[model samples]
Target: MDGDKSLFAWVVENYKDGHLICDDQSGETADFLHISASSRTLSFIHVKKSGSSSEQRKISASAHEVVIGQAVKNLIWMDFTALRTRLESPPIEEPACWNSGVKGSDRSAFLAAFDRRDATSRTEIIIVQPHVREAHYKHLHENGLDHEQISEDTLRLHLLEGLLNAARSTTTSVGADLFIIGSSD
Candidate 1:
């Protein structure tokens, strides 16, 4: 994640077309959904990002903590500085995360709900993106890169970006959200 926005492409590539479900009962390890409907469409669940203190506590205690790259070490072996440079310099068509000022929080509960194997498989991706801090955006502006022209999706993209940008060896596991896909397999 390097805290940069340009590195989001990789995250998107990795996550798209994958199965998403919540672990309502903490049953089986989550798996890919290679069945009908074939991901007909996707939507966002945007939540107002304020009073972050409670939000932080909620996510930290979430049943599943998506661990990336063998461990949290994914934060390491990263060129965050270089990533930042590219994000501000190119002023790519895609907006950088710095604009929204939303911090990354866990999306486990949303998935945990999917882990359930009952009649009501209710729950959808709630694109809860937080706003980026003003300071990060200020730093980008001072870099001589004019990103003021671009829009802001700083929050939703954080998770997607992280998934896309993660190294191949990196694995994102929602152990707490695992439930059997079918009656058997």
Candidate 2:
């Protein structure tokens, strides 16, 4: 994908079995809200892109901050009641989210799943950004303590990791999972 919009489309398409109840790429709501009946899980997906494809190999603290902020700020909408309200009556006219693949029957079934969901049902906040490379994040997760101040990029990576950790902690407290979809490079 070239950017966040494309990434959002790809994610929604790839999630074959789930119902994409929300697809608000205009910043008015979550980028994507999905529910999987069989998995009994709901997901809030937020997408962010680096400055350029070349930047994908580098960790951008600013990018992470913006994406994570979006994810954390929208946590209040995780409630089933709030989602139902949005589903029934969108805040704007001709909302793109409401015109998605979800049908009336699908919404009803998903709503039933939401209502009957217990402690076993799971929720997730996903931050999809190509700014942070997977290997770099893993290295920081593993040998971060040993490396003293290496470079500006390293410092930025550390800051990004810290932000991710804090966001994860906040989501965990609310009984949701937090994770990053960083670059494979």
Candidate 3:
């Protein structure tokens, strides 16, 4: 597996027992959406490549913003009734990149896991990069809106709150417990 594909595969393997939805193609909303039945957790993942240079990888400020933005956008989309409906009955055909036999075999469990009435589910917005660096944090502070008035923690909280609000507005009737995870090498 190559860079992007490798990350995708890792995500698939990590959540093998769950319902995985791939949206990595052009014009898609997210790289992958993993909904775990046993845990009642929904994860929206966005994968991006780090800069080639070692220094760049440690300070790719622009990449940080872009990946985080994309993940937030995908989270908002997840709140839509139409998207949730589609998620409930995902296409049977697995993406070519998925490992063999990773496709959802338990249709009943898959459907039940996403049951709109399950109001106590948790949601996560995950951004996977090659690595994270101190520069990324500094960049966020320096470039963030409000002339650096907003802290990184505040910005993340705002985004997560927005996602939870959107999820509540959906037919799911769930008030999602939100979390944001930025994982890197």
lDDT of 3 by residue, 1-185 (tens): 33555667677767665676676766555787667756767666778765553654433335456766675555556554666665554454544322222564434444455574255677766667654454554565566655637765546645644544553344133333333344442
Backbone collisions counted per model: 25, 0, 0
lDDT per model, in order?
A: 0.27, 0.70, 0.56
Judging by TM-score against the true structure, name the best candidate.
2
How do the predictions measure up, each by TM-score?
A: 0.19, 0.78, 0.58
lDDT of 2 by residue, 81-128 (tens): 776676666555544332134333334544555667677888889888
Candidate with maximal lDDT = 2
Q: Per lDDT, what order, best first?
A: 2, 3, 1
- Model 3: pairs clashing at backbone N, Cα or C within 3 Å: none
